[model samples]
Structure formats: C-alpha cells, structure tokens
Target: RKPGFTLGAGILPFTHADYIGEVRESGLSYLSAIKNATQYRQISDDITLNAYAAYIFGLIDLAFPDGRPVGFWFNQIKQALYLIDSGLDPQIIANVIEVQMLKEYGVEPNWRGCVIDGRADLPLDFSESYGGLLCQNHWDKDPHRLHASPRAIFYLRRFSTLDLNKVERINVKLDTKAELRRILDVIYTDMVGVTPKAKRFLDQMHQWQDRLPDDSE
Candidate 1:
C-alpha cells in the first residue's frame, strides 16, 4: 500500500554495496580508502551506531586535525582489526576503537549512567583489590574517590587466582588510566554495580548521616 516508503526501505540493503563500491573504486583518495578499509559488517548495533556517527561527523578530517594529516583514523581501524585478529571480542574492540577515534578527533562522548548503582557488574571484591593496588602503586592515596583504580586491583586479584601469568601479561598491556577505567566500567555496568533503587536508598542514608552532628564525649 505504501509503495514509495516501501521501495526506499527495500533499497536500503543495496545501499551498503553502493557505499562500499564507491570507496573501493576511489582507491586514490585517502578518505575513500579509509572509508573502504573501515567498512565492517557483523558488528553489534551499538558499534554500528558509533562507527556511523564517526563517519558522519567528518572523522576522516578530524583525524588530521592541526593539519598534520597523520592518518590516525586508519591507524585505529588497523589496531581494531589487529585486536580482532588476536581473538578479542568484536564489540569490546569496537568500543575501544570508537573511544580512541573520539579522543583523536577531539570528540567527547556524553557518558550517561546512574552514578552509584549503574555499575553492578563491578565486583566489590575486585574493586577493593584494585583499590589496594592503586594505593600500593601510589597511583592514588585514596581509592574511595578513584573509581577504576580500585577495580584494577580487583582484576589483579581475580586474575591472580585464575592465572597469575596471564594476569601479568594483561597488566602489562593495560598501561593507561583510560584502559583501566574502561575495564572497570564494563565490569561495574554488567556484573558488579547495584540497582538504581538500591543506590538511591544508599544515597538517602548518606544524606541522613551528613545531617547528624558529631558527638565527641
């Protein structure tokens, strides 16, 4: 009944090939080559949205900010593929790549989530362990305020019990605050964080505690 809308919708699948072919045929153009090389299927919905956003927001040009023409966008694509080739989860690798692309291109992603209960997957034990490690390393004197540092300690603890050698290997690879944060965020959001209602109740308790006056006899 709705032939016009239906026709366009039906043609949507064909547009994939058209886009791929356009970039592939224009091999001489760096932008086109990057686009072609970065084209990926079988990505998760979230990753697909992120990649589409990057492409639309002039990621190719953004990668060359300061007029340096460094081809960092291509480099990110290469790195992501390398990780995938090395058996990393495609969605995780895609998220990492998207984050790197945003940073390189000077785009700040608007992160949204509940402050306390948002990350239930983050194991409390792991957070404590990571927090201890952070303290030992002098990364931060106070782990309570440093979100992921404590979580890194937790990772170290769990990995230590499972495979100490692999723990060391992974630790070596994780050299940045951003990487640490990402790992903790995933764990917290998926497994360790609490529910929103629990978080709210906790917050209310804290507020009640704050209102109480100190009594030193």
Candidate 2:
C-alpha cells in the first residue's frame, strides 16, 4: 500500500451518509440496531440527538479546508459529543459552535461589559447588529436591543468557555432552560439570519415528543 502506487481507493471524497452509517454501526448508540429504549418515551429524540452529534462532527470535518484549525475543531467537536453523551442540552453544543462560527466570520457578540467602554454594572442587553452584549445605556440608544437575563448570561458564559466534562455534572432549572432557549434562538437568528434545518427538526421533534398517548374510549 505505497503512496500513489496502485488504485484510486480511499482517495475519493467520503460522503456524510457514509460516515453516518459507519458511526451507526460502530456501536456508539446502536441507533440502526435498536428501535426504542426500554423506559424512555423519547427514544426518537435520543436517536435524533445522536444523529445531530454526527452532523456536528461532519461539519467540523468539512470546515478544516476553509482555514479552520484542525486541533481547535477537534477539541470543540469532542466537547460537543461529550455534551451529548452526557445527556446535556444539545443547544449548548449548538450555540458553542454557532458562537465560534460567528466569531470566525467576524460576527461574534460583544457581551463584555456592554460593548466595551460602557458601564460594567448596567443591565445586560443584546444587539445583533452591534455584535455583542450592551448595557442599558448602549441598548437604549439602539432600537434593536433585546433583554438578556442574568440566568441567560450565566449559561452563555458557559458556552463561551465550556468545560464539556464539567458541564455534564450540572443541572439547570426549568425556567432557566426556557430562558436559555429564548436567548439562544434570538442570538442565532440575528447572527446567522436563518434557522438551520437541524434546529427546526429538533424543535418539531420536541413538540411531537410532548404529546400524550391517545386514550380514546
């Protein structure tokens, strides 16, 4: 198997579908083998989460040739899977990558003390057009500002520098969970200007999973 010796084998581009099949068979979650979990009502959701993990890795695999650092992406993706495998909210992982994507393309938010040179103690506000967090002073000047609660800020800070291992050990409140989703949805929409298909699928699956089993008499 010398280099440039025999055939074009392994030289062609590998499709993501191929990668998904490989991972599915590799026994990570046995997604293709198992139909449902024994006790969970949300097995479909779990399967979708596993697929989402693969999707994230696929994105990172393809992103390297476009000037992304391999090591950085590797770490980030490993952390993403860690978050997923540990049963944490995939939104955290999604926002982590989304934030980095924004920053890489010069769209990262300015969540640092109200967009710099502003009062540090002022209430935190978000301005997508301004590229970060704003204080009451700055937010009031802009008509497009959105409020960010301290709870939302707490989780956003975690996404900024999340220790994937450490985050797996923590729990979040229901109210905090709802607020985080609100803050993240706005941030992502403003930053990217479109809802990703994966996000839509996850949202739909969430709603579908919440329906009670029909008990028609």
Provide the lowest-lDDT 10-residue window in model 1.
Answer: 12-21
Q: Could you give candidate 1's per-residue lDDT for residues 110-178 as a string of tens digits?
A: 222122333433433223333222323332434443344444444433432242112112223434434
Top-TM-score structure, candidate number: 2
Superposed model 2: Cα runs more than 4 Å off: 1-45, 58-69, 194-196, 209-217
Candidate 2 lDDT, tens digit per residue, 131-173? Answer: 6777766666668766667767757755776555566455677
Q: Ten consecutive residues with minimal summed lDDT in candidate 2?
A: 13-22
Candidate 1 CA-lDDT value: 0.37
Tell me the alpha-carbon RMSD of every candidate.
Answer: 15.7, 10.1
Give model 1's clash tally.
19
